[model samples]
Target chain A: MKTLKYITLFAAISTSLLFVQCKDDDDNVITQETCTDGIMNGEETGVDCGGPDCQPCGLVLDFSGTYIQEDQMGRPGINTVFGTEGFKDAFNVTVPSQMQAAFQEKFETKLLGLNPAYTSNALGLDASTFTTVLSNDVLWLAQSGVTTYFNGTEILTGRALSDDVIDVSLLLIFGGPMGDQNPGLTSDGVPTNDAAFSNSFPYLAGPF
Target chain B: MKKSKLFAVIGGIGLAVLSIFLISADHIDAPAVQGTTADITDFYAFQGQNTSNFVFIANVQGLLSPGQPTDEAVFDETVLLEFNIDYNNDLNEDLVIQAIKRGDSMYFFGPTAPAFSGEEGTKSTIATSTRRSVKISTRDDVQIAEQDGMKFFAGPREDPFFFDFNQYNAVLSGTASSFNNPGMDTFAGTNVLSVVVEFPKSMLPGGTTGVNQFAPSTPMYNVWVEAKRKQ
Candidate 1:
């Protein structure tokens, strides 16, 4: 019986040791797996667990809408030229020859620093007709000449020019006349235009 | 013997608990973005001069590479893209134009413009159209081509956004000292999901006239867009 008692006590002690060893190993495994709250120096390193600690991906509210005056009543504003019917089909006058040279000369001299190799050859319109085409087709520029293109087709024809502002503004907005005096390009190598240029007429909408 | 049996039970229990904990930990370590969410990179609403209608574009699936074709295939079919219109001074949705995509095609639900302002789902459908099979080309009207008497286009197209994410990231992380001379565009060669919708100016809450007499009377109307996940 004494021998039996000894055996029982030994077995109990061994089992207790095994339990303690298992507990330590379990703890070590947990420490190895989740060693840092799954965070590194307060930085999240684990998948979002749908809890307060986990940050689920979401749709960020982007409220960057730019409001422009819309045409209203019988007395629509000059800016409302596009909404008016028969605006596009109206007779499109060619730009005057003398004005083309002056405009091109001025643009080349004043804006060439913005766009290198700024030649009129690439411009779809000749010097004499460029202004009229721009005034009629371009939405952002203030209309100085006869405004006619209200139809989407004429506007669509000028979509490339309208979209080209992304490039033009890059040069002119920063280094040319409108850019910040601080000599540096935007992260994309485009010169940073002055803040005022961004606020200037016809705020070109962007996520560009 | 009883004492030994009790100790063995405790050890077994301890082991079982540890195993469960480790399993849970493994699951928590996986790094995959969740579904049922929409990431809108850009929203554009403007009057189309070429037409009497206004244009609405929702750009998604941002920062995609030309080689990442598989990721482009995962647009959720059940997700609904809705365009809300508020006609009056109240900041509520008055009209809704919803669109959904199926295998290689898109279906527009409504231009749901009512004689008076109200919720969108309840409004009547004005027109319906479907786009051609999906490809890297421009296609026209997927559904409700004309709602409140306006045209629409729903399909895939190259992302129009251009941004230099690498430079931007460097700027944020304090690794880069300054932007480049002309700047670098990380998104120069990327693509995104695009949804374009056009409507008549008359359909909007603001009258068709070019004056400031419209409700929500700011020179620039405050508008944001979203794509809600289906339940």
Candidate 2:
């Protein structure tokens, strides 16, 4: 009985010492992986900035002084086809609310310059109304309906990953009511993505 | 704990804060910002698998070669990616979803209410009252996270846009009237950095909406993505 009691006491002592040794490391166990605790813990250089949990300061582009306009894409060719180089910066920097007023005439002129025939599109939206929509520069989405850039039935009701937006835009801009006017000029030909997209959340395809 | 229920990733852009805006589509345009992190190749918005949910995607840095190693890229830390939603047909975002990348995690904030709205958006210095983050997946493995009824994912994804730029330029140059039946896929065999988010439709403010394309006063939801640098 004495021997047994001694062994049990020794085991208990050993376990307590191990716990004591690990006390400091245990503090980080709960917080090591967390980034937004508002406290700069772990290897983070700033408050929730730097280290593994957040992007390091080194990787960020240095835009310290001027916040110049970089790039903009809402509908496929709004800026590329419509906005002139002189107006590109203006169009890009212009807020959507103020876009149409500033760029509608320019957009119409560009449209007429491109097609020349200059009539209503298949959607029945004339140059003024159509340019108005494009000038706002935003992808319109429907909450409870089929999602596509344009599917003959629904127009500009959000876009799916597989929607041939370029084709639709071409048909509207170059093709007439029956969509056969500029059949040759309508499609860019390349269809579908290089790979298959995921069916679940983040629905993008795996990088090649 | 608290991080799971409430945290915000204010995707920082620009000089000190980055703001990414998606307005037009072009592979290699924008002379100043071409091939940089501000280069937004494409932006997509769609209804989620559940009709009540919505998904927003912003793809940047197009033509990252499929097999090229000299081209590894990251979501510029100095940049902030913001999705602007105009639910009232006003052409301004009433609500914004901001995404920022840190380390190997992507943080998202506010399909909440907009604290700031305009052309050059100043990222709120306030940490997202609600914070949610997901692990950044690599090429070998993918990462996803679900929290507060929203799902998030970030990292490299295959480029899904299909277009024949050669044929397109040909038509534009007046050499052709239209285009070929099956033009070559120029974007094939390439990859892009994608940040994706899916959330409840109700999260965005909308009540009076459009009945059809011809309807007036219909709440047309206008969405665009932006990359802004901190000033």
Candidate 3:
């Protein structure tokens, strides 16, 4: 019995010592991996990553993935008038080349829905042709021309800062072939911007 | 445990500050970008005063109230402003000029070829050869930077798009038959972050002769602007 007791005590003592040694090892490990330390110390490939204790570094290039397109605008108010809630988000992201094929029919449906009497606009295009043009929401500019949005004779060459686009849009949508169909519906009474546009480079008026 | 709790508090405060800078609701069409820096209000392209050059203007963060502090309405550095030019009329961006704000200045890259363009969106990479950097204007004095005959400006400007939004909404809703005489200009007192660029027509495709010409073979360019954020 005495010998058995001595054996049991020795075993217990050995196990306790092993446990103490393991705790010391854990303390050493904690000291070794200080990933939170901003310095690129230890085994870090980047500041804190690519080490055994932290995640790996991808080594992304500067301005490599700089920005993503969250919004696209070609022509003003094309998506706003035609695209409803669910459709608006998709239309904004749709590539201009694919826009006609993807959204032309829907645009036609909305256009007709807006003006049931839309036989044709000032552009002399029928519903089908107009919607096809509108669906590809890119602003076309002539490389050489008197650049104006719509100056009675010139149309859609390019937009001048002073061009009354909203009035023109209203006239095109509501006006008949002669562009005088609904006098009331056409031309939002606001003719000019509150502030005058500068005639120089960076033509927009300075902010108040 | 204490360190982790401290990190959590700091993270929460960071997010709160970011959210305050982010909430901008302006453009009517794009619900996704409406309340963010990605909202594009208007785009204008025209013949420059130096008729040999063409001017392209893009406006974002529309309808900023005049009463609001200037710092609150400044351009978001996270958003990338891009002007896409389709010289071939393929409805694809053959060339693009990109601008982004960094530390009170706007950096520009490329009248060069885009890294990629489509519905997949553009991964903007700075073109080292054609890069230009300009100071961003904050006050009434307009700041412009000119280099190698290319002129650039990024700043706040009056919301130039005049619209009777309330009347239009009424008309669309079928509640009104027509817009009123002298309709309210919804964008009158508002401001927008504006980026303007003017470069010689010779820089475009097929104009390599370095002279502005109306040759029939010269392509009519389709232009557009996009506001992008880092993914």
Best by lDDT: 3
- In candidate 1, position B207 carries an lDDT of 26
> After superposition, which runs of candidate 1 have C-alpha atoms over 4 Å from their true positions?
A1-208, B1-37, B49-51, B67-74, B113-149, B207-221
Give the alpha-carbon lDDT of every model: 0.34, 0.68, 0.72
Clashing pairs in 3: none
Chain A TM-score for each of the predictions: 0.19, 0.67, 0.68
lDDT of 3 at A157: 73
DockQ of 3: 0.24
Instruction: For model 3 chain B, give the 10-residue run with minimal summed lDDT.
Output: B207-216
* lDDT string, candidate 2, B63-178, tens digits: 78765541367787666777878777666667888777766677787776655566544343323666677887888878888877899988888888887765665454444445
Stretches of candidate 3 off by over 4 Å are: A1-62, B1-26, B118-123, B207-219
TM-score for each predicted model, relative to the true structure: 0.40, 0.77, 0.76
CAPRI band for model 3: acceptable
Q: Can you rank all candidates by DockQ, best first?
A: 2, 3, 1
